[model samples]
Target chain A: MSDIVEIHMPKLGESVAEGTISEWLKAVGDSVDFDESLFVVETDKIATEFPSPEAGVLLEILVPAGETVPIGATLARIGPAGAATGASPAAAKPADAAAAKAAAMAAEVAEPATAAAPATASAAPAAHKGGELLSPLVRRLAAEHHLDLAQIAGSGANGRIMREDVEAAIRKQLQPAVSKVAIPPVAPVSASSSPASPPAAKGDKVVPLSRIRLVTAQRMVESKRIAPHVWTSVEVDYENIAKVRARHKDRFKAETGASLTYLPFVMRAVADALHAFPAVNSSVDIEAKTLIMHSEVHLAVAVDLDEKGLMAPVIRNADMFNVRGLAKAVQAVSAAAKKGTLTPDQLQGSTFTLTSPGPLGSFASAPIINQPNVAIMATDGVARKPTVVGDAIAIHHLGVLGLCYDHRAFDGVTTARFLDHVRTSLQERDWEAEIG
Target chain B: MPTNKEQVAEEVTYLDAISQALAAEMERDESVFLMGEDVGQFGGAFKISKGFMERFGARRVVDTPIAENGFTGMAAGAAICGLRPVVEFQFADFISQAFDPIINVMARHHYRTGVPVPVTLRCPFGGRLRAGPTHSQSIESYFAHVPGLKIVAPATVEDAAGLLISSIRDNNPVLFLESKYLYRRLKVPAPLSLEPTPLGVAKVAREGTDVTLVSYSVGVQQGLEAAEVLAREGISVEVIDCRTLVPLDIDTIVKSVKKTSRAVVLHEAARRLGYGAEIASEIGEACFWFLDAPVTRIAALNTPIPTSPPLEDAVLPQTEEVIETLRKVARS
Candidate 1:
């Protein structure tokens, strides 16, 4: 049997379903001892190292680096030192995947020891709908969210809407993609959609949705419902900025300890264009049915936390900032995000948005409009592309800029103009003037 | 059930209702008299017996010194002689001083000697006035356990009058509890003929199919309020006022509970062995299988009433608590 042994992923926590393999510490065939960190895995909550249960040689690594597989799936295998090729555990067949996923999900949903026994829902409900009332807090939430109380089935006494039911409904309202129509006939429409709620899954492994994921899910649903988002994209040539940045890259970093990136240059152009088209730097008060335009542009920059989630911390009042200042603000915000010390106020009061999916290697994206705010712009990756320069073909630093604006505030033409303005600003910024 | 058709009358305050019941009973029987610390000249502590002296004369409305134990013994002696005596304690807390006369003499007179002690002890009770622990007490729960005495607490003006008259006319000694908070606050139609509502008969103050809410005195008022709030959200709450505690109207409670499959009992007394607990136990025994949820009890915290307005308010059971308990019970 080659004495082959497999090191499956361990149960992480009560709420963690899957963990990303951040790095494999021991490569295949590396000799290891018990308690040695074999690999590092990162859940949304924390990054933990898995230790070798027994002293052995590291064998085949099943899951690769950066892949987020269900927890308890085989990460790597180990055996007696210098075990030959046939000693490795065979790859999981088709049947193994489903079973592994279910086990991983079960661990995430393990109730705390202190959790009281749950109330059974399937017990034949006593006949008749009585006037079982909702509490003040639950009522307030239903009113605030405009949820139909009749539509929500309460887990409360006599089918009353306890605070928990309302909270579950509020969470479900955020993900319109999973609304009644979208929830396949597997479960009832009025059933709880909370990640914490137990779903009657025959083969499905449901895990609790992380807090960040819940918030993003809600915002995405709200933005789609409130704003008629119209997107327009324009390709830009960044050859001049590339040359200017290449010339002063080392000096800029040495002096300011900040890498001069195209984001700051793009942010500078966005601020300038926001000033020209002031209507774009405004929010829609849907309730009051009013449009509020801002004199100063508080630019929200969408920073992806290595795909854990997205956080758009505002670079408050970016219009007055030059290229260097914008770069510093971007760098400061990104650093605060990495250290997880960003203040609450830093996240709010965004009048316009600039998202750099460029760093994440996206060539083009139609990002959703950050609601209340009239517009959001996605900075696509800059790559070398051939362009005709006065009838001669030449390689240039090329990028695409996409703008998604609220059509409630303006038409497609105006949004296109705003997008064109951003494209022109990026292509024509006098980079040498600022570089010197 | 004898058919005596009763007519609606004008509205009266809870205090006036008590006053009218005393005057009407005294005039009808000629032997019924009232005695308390300030009941005659000063018109009682809450003026519940106000103007009784002017109409009934000093002989009938006899004012006594601040001696609950002494005067209560005298009243028990008078009841033994065929005089229906209604004795008032300024606040219910002082009833503890008269516990000997209540349990030993008046409560056991009919059983011990076959002579009916038709004495009604009027106790004005309940917290939430910033009244300290001694003054604001719901003490019926203590005597509710006594075998010989009938504990009757009234929440509305109508119940206060109807139950008081019934207490005065009963053969056994009765503890008539009137919530001080609801004394002059709640008003109901005055009885044109002083028709007494039969004792131990529970009144469904508000009806709903979802759950049955059993409460007495001030707790009934809170249940009504909780019902109104819940009704706005479409939760139908059935509130029952168990006017008489000792001879509880279990039939009314059981019927409502059996229909709803959920029940909750509420009172202003401390929760540990409170009257509500007695009702809960009875429900568990009688309607065990019919219940969809465990019977719940809502009562004041098991602590003395605080003098601080906020603290005292916190100690007493609230409509919010009733709403919360009923929500859980109905769902269960």
Candidate 2:
């Protein structure tokens, strides 16, 4: 084994490609043990302190504070306390070979030839591949240190730079001005280049969407594009449903430990209606030009995520679940979505979707169809208003039901019939029969 | 205060100013368009975009069905696809039909995905024109509860044009609630250029010192009228027009309240749980120490807006109510 050992920055996380050096714990010529704190680096998400991997005297500090470097770049040199300045024959040979292999890999990766050539040519043939050209090791180092090869000057054999050469360049550039360091003024890249434009200017702050939000946006856009949607709204007399809910509130809560919401009852009614009118519960296979109807109901309930808006998590085999089960499922999925703990499986595979604006006071709303699904049911706020029933004016608990369907898959008559079924099921209080 | 140009130009309505803003923006940016019921040939329920159909044509000045939800959703989709769509609700009260698209979808678009919904909803709101309950409402508070939605209620004709233009260009979903009562009643000279009035900002409509009167929409005019009356009585009142409600321009409210140490919020909406509650709460939270007296809110009585003019006048907050609230707060 060679006596000289190379010190490189380590990869910290899966997505983090580079980190900015926040501070250096030690200086050049400092003796450090393996696993000793060396420097602190900051990434967009988090900051962490890196430790030395090899126990030896730090021959050179190759990077400086406030400079960003990539993963696996040579951060420093660690060797025996009194080792010779020149690389050992054995060490130098493999380093040269590694560099040569990296150069070949770089050529395959299609890295900018002009930018990487000098570093690849100067590094020893073995070290050329192993160092900066483009090896797994160099890539990892570049990611950790956030080092851009285009900026560094390579000093390896034939001007082919290795990892060490890149690190040396970074260290030289970052060093404090000892004798009026000739620093070039950073030119304004562009008006848009500023991470965030100043507040005085008409600028905006953009935050990237989390995984759930991204999925929601994509699904919504897809739904709108794929589905030619037409909406029909009808105000239903929720008098019976509200009365039933009020009467059995305590009993339902005691039995299930879950408050009976209009949502679960609505979901149950929708499921029963779906059973009768399967076409409304079907999805179109755009590629196959076929309508796929499912016997089992996988109902997606739209859950409000407060500031993050809405996400739909499906309740699988919803037809089999009772009102209590539906409520539990809705609550669970909603909790998972709000907390952002929902797995991919939890979000996928729904035959139909339901959305409600709750008490935020929308009388009626046409919900966009969840793509691939044939229809979506949107329930509006329940308000006590006067309604005419059989030529008699009565103060009924009125709630508007908005049904938006893909006209390509289902016709207005079919959707209206399905909505009628939903209305009848809710008014009848036949929960057990519907569940059965 | 009539300038030569203002005296020469036909006295344009507030709705006309808004139409001018839309026409100007559409001409300036190819990405800007208008979508609402009867916006194209029918011109709009209030005729705000009357000549827009001829000027911009069908593609840009779109006539949508009475499906508030559908059109609002379509506008949101268009906005996401890099188009600036100004959607008009025939009556602000009818906006309830499009709540999901506005609050759930458009308002949350940016915060959820960093994708902007540069969509503007121009609603002819408020009561007193005998439009009755279904047509008359001031539901701006309903949208103000939403996080990413910017609510602008422009009082003056300048703000009517500027805020509508600003709302059109904003990178967030904006609710531009124009008082139906002010549609034809207010007037101003045509703007030199189509410049946007900043959103989430307030302006001191009338300067005073004894008490600060904060209001928006038609209530702003009432507040200004009340301020003039109070000024004669030696009560210096500062009247503030809260142009945008959601981004409440709390700094300006706080600053004015700090100076006056007394405030009276006037609105034509229902007194209980109206947007006045929000303003009063904000003032209490931010300027509690600076306040000499509790923030008083003078709003319409909690009742369905009546159709009879006298009944409507009785229920709605008038200039007298604003004056009364100012006097009360000032004395306290």
Candidate 3:
């Protein structure tokens, strides 16, 4: 007899159900050695290569690369040890061999059972034959309940049975009937134990808060309790800025290969204003009783990631980058944050922040200050409307800026001046000169 | 003080039961408080919180500004600071204004930070009284779409009181949608204890094998009434109250559908993108092979609820619609 070797895919992990074959190092008809790299599989979390278990000629490859097979499934077959011609009988056409093995087992069982019975009893009627030992009704009921014939152990003549056997089997498995009993209802708990006291009796349900919203709630509360927030709103005439944006947008995109947005313009204005009023760029130290002025401005731009939530990704050193560079950074950071692929470093280090509810046409929003930052600015929805331009009312691009600052750190006057600076910078933008 | 006999046997509306849950939770747990427009001295627009202010005082039972966004945000803050805030939206329709706080920040807080927001937003939704488009609205589907936010709609007074307590003690943001129509209608024997009803569990209000009527809020009552009416006609319909929409009790739904092989989802919200659609889809996916008929949804028409009584009646789903849908599902 030849030893039959069963080849199977190695179990990768406890939870891994399947793995994709990334590469196959061995080819058919190639001589292989033990522990040789056979193929690599890639799972969602990690990738690893499987090694050959035994030394032999590569007889067959059951699975191919880029295919995912279940654990214990045949992956490849290797010739058994000490086999002639380097090919074991076990490696021969698996399908035919399996069929031959099944046929032999069936014959072996039949040979013994038939020899013990009378060879010729004139072939008992088909209904009373060994194969038909189970009555039609019994067979039908057994099939309906998915019961095995052998498990039932028939008790009729020559171990044959009728409908009574099937019914008995079912009755044995089913519950015995019993008379119903009535029980009095219990009294409810006193009103004191009830959460909805006084009016609510019992059988009330209570649900809890979600994690993300809970954190947001906590942060907002802490910010409000710790930071003395004072709001300053101002309208900005963006007539010149809008004109410059429209004129240079195509050129800017073509030159830099980055989409130009109103955010870049607003960011540049805010950066310049921060330089002009350094106090707005500073934060109040609640513990040290002093204001900490940062040398660099790490601007945190809050992006609406979804309908319900906002995420702020910082663009380090906003003062150092021009409008085009700011746009690129914002686009990259915002994209990364939205996909939840941002690294730890990407979300950290911010001295100031900006939030916008654009296109939705929110006129103004009082952004909660990112703690330790004395101020945060918000850009409102921009729309074209009639505005006083010099001596005449004309349709010019206009928008409102809502500035919220910690009153303890920066006074309303300082906040107002910062807004004016941003307004002046946007309204008086000489795009050609600024870009150069 | 003499014990008033009326106090012992007095009947209260389901809305009052909800308020009582809030009041009791607030008194028992120091962290519990009430926050929303008119929830204080005004005692809630629906008067659910009526007399709460005199009992709990202004500090705990506080009224808020018209700023839905602002007050909701503040309530989120209070919840995070260890206070359990039960926010009452004057009308479920007004909840859209605070959608940001409910969906974005509060729903995400627990998943992002591992800290729970024990905040419950109470919305009096649904319509039968000609409240028109503004006052009567069912936006439960909007919040149910969001993860990490538990959506609970109690059809019976027992659930109304029990769900409120569960929401307070729960460690996540919960959208408690109270049906305004059922607030004074459905009544049940008071539960034996104040224990919370488990979330994600469905109750088979009435059982039969001909057809399954799946619903929550006022729809559950409608389903029950429909089932009763159908029973007299020899079509046995099972009514299931899906108290929670998010962590849907899919097992119960699947088992019921497997036994009955037919199902109808009933809700007061518009048919398009409504919670009923979600239920129908889930049922089809889970019990497809077992289903004898395609899941049918009986919901309000896809239109803004009109002011006229005739228009409103035409737009909103009724017991007849549920019964018809059940019959069709059963036959198919």
Candidate 4:
């Protein structure tokens, strides 16, 4: 028997050329038993503890922990003391291992240093069998698009797929889908269509868009891309609500310490309408092909941030609150949004949304729906207009409410009915009594 | 008539810039002195110290015999005694003769003791003048492995002045590897801001988005030339000049490689175990996910340089080879 048995790194799996010595279980000169765990080796595929081939006193450690080396590199040496003669007392399969060792020793004597050659040769085809020869960037890009690597042709050296090759394949795949539709090339530009900004003039001030604005832009584009939208509008008579506000405005402000606004009245009507028409207050799980009709109306109110950007903070359980209670909650959330102090929780879980373009004197504006909500309504300007009432020309306060909905959630009839319900509640509900 | 700033910006060669930096440091500090063979009355082997003996006097600029080990050891002792001694080697190839003093004595002394050794050895290195194997050699890879020594190889005329001053002022042993090929071939506006180019910071010589060429010393000039020719064929290339080999600024290299997704490391040293291997390995580990192709290396053949011009040209990295590598990487 040899005096010293050199411990070499074992072949770790297919395509594993090297591994890191993550840890050593025993220090130098420590006694070892055959088939006992020795050290931990971590390769790209797995981390495993290797066992001692020969039981002896550990003589020397060539490769220290935290160092990586190629396969077949010497790791340590086991001296003759306490060495096993032919088998071990605790070996799991002594006969099989002894025969294998004899064969390996014979092979080693025939071709020294050729142990790793066959392993490397066997690993090459197994590596090429999976992904063929695509670079890391190309592999990630292909995985992102759910592309089959075997189908795409590579143009790099040795047919290795490069980044440009993957990108070219993606462009080629998109051509047929685009040209199949005879639609005009004048379609609205997509978010990814124009990655670069238009050239600026010599005197132009090029300030990068704020982070909030960028996020808002990306979400808006994503919402449009996923949802097919349809818009519906309805005119509401606010004459009765205006008269009630005239009677109770000063008292309501003095009692609540908050100014009475038409937003609360509109929010009250919206909540009631959402309860009446549940489909309009529901979200659609497109992947699952199901509608989620939330029981409570968590209303997301759009707040403008001093012309910089927009934020939508939710008013939890808006349906449970009356006009005055809704007024306080809306004011608190709007103030928080303006002050940049809204928590992430306050901005999520909205089942319905409302955008007030009326303050800016806009009419019949179509606001994008805040996802994953199914609908968003815009309350436009309110003004006194001459209208015919029972065959007589009369002056009335009126406003136009526009509702944009995901067509997949509900059809045009549902959107129209939901808006009309809000209009009826706003025009005929006892607003004076409710405020008092 | 030239304005004050214009007169201050008079052009100078790379060799003149080196001479000016040494003179400036010696004048600024009384403790600073120059010691090398023929550095005094003979005015240096390359005429770098032509007027140093007359201006600073013989005491400040002392010439020594052709004994590298003796003078190098003397410089180490002088540095420990609080004097800034700048030693010059005629050719970087001859540094091996003094390897014992440089590696064993000067390099480990400061680490063992808290005392600082401020010795700067000026080595005129690189091959292009048919200086044969003994005279034309790059020794950066040899010294880069040492722990206590800082290595800086300046490519441009401006850096030849600024980096040397920084090395002289540094409170550690620094090997200032000056390129003998670019000593006269490169020129820059004189009156260089003699401000120290901080060690371990890389400079982007040219910016492009297609592929990055990481190099230093003479390789930087070759990369720039290759980038110029590749631009005509619509292949963009970014060139990074690693001014210092020790305390390498891998951040800049990684950033460029991340943007370009491909890289090529170039050097004039032998391909086997050269300084470029370290840079290439660092790039592989840092920018693994961003690589579109393997990190290629274009360097001298793994053989000693021959005396013949044609043979030397074949051994050393050339602009055409760099251009070809760039084209391959850019397309990949």
Ranking by TM-score: 4, 1, 3, 2
Pairwise TM-score winner, candidates 1 and 4: 4
lDDT of 2 by residue, B1-332 (tens): 22123323666667667877777788889999888888888878877777777777799989887799999999999999999988888998989999998888998888889898899888889998888888999988788777888889989888888888888888888888998888888876544345788887899898877789889889889988888888888888998999888788888988998777778888888766789889989998887755555577777655677787766765676676567557655642
Task: Give a tens-digit lDDT track for model 4, residues B1-332.
Answer: 12122224567778878887888899899999999999988889998888788888999898999999999999999999999999999998989989999998889998889888999999999998999989989889989998999999999988998999999999989999999999989987655667778998999999998899999999999999999999999989999999999979999999999988999999999777799899999999998888887788877765567688866776677676688668867874
Query: What fraction of the real A-B contacts shows up in model 3?
Result: 0.00
Q: Candidate 4 on A37-76: residue-level lDDT in tens?
A: 8899999889999887666777767678887876666567
Off by over 4 Å in 3: A1-436, B1-9, B189-193
- What TM-score would chain A of each candidate receive against the reference chain A? 0.56, 0.58, 0.53, 0.57
Residue A130 in candidate 1, Cα distance off native in Å: 23
Task: Encode model 1's per-residue lDDT on B7-63: one tens digit a residue.
Answer: 133557787778777778888898899998988888888877666788789998899
Cand. 2: chain B TM-score:
0.94
The backbone clash count of each candidate, in order, is: 10, 54, 40, 1
- In order, the TM-score of chain B in each prediction is 0.95, 0.94, 0.95, 0.96
Model 2 misplaced regions, further than 4 Å: A1-436, B1-8, B190-193
What digit string (tens of lDDT, one per residue) describes model 1 on residues A158-276? 45555556668888888785574464676455554444746567988777788799999999998988898888888899998999999998999988888899998888888888888
lDDT of 2 by residue, A12-120 (tens): 5667666677887877667777668888878888888876655667665556677676654555555667753433221111111121122122222232322111111
- Report lDDT per candidate: 0.78, 0.75, 0.74, 0.82
Candidate whose lDDT is highest? 4
RMSD of each: 31.5, 32.5, 31.6, 14.5
Among the numbered candidates, top DockQ falls to 4
Give the least accurate 10-residue stretch of model 3 chain A, judged by summed lDDT. Answer: A115-124
Tell me the TM-score of each prediction against the true structure: 0.45, 0.43, 0.44, 0.52
Clash count, candidate 2: 54
Candidate 1 runs further than 4 Å off: A1-436, B1-11, B189-193
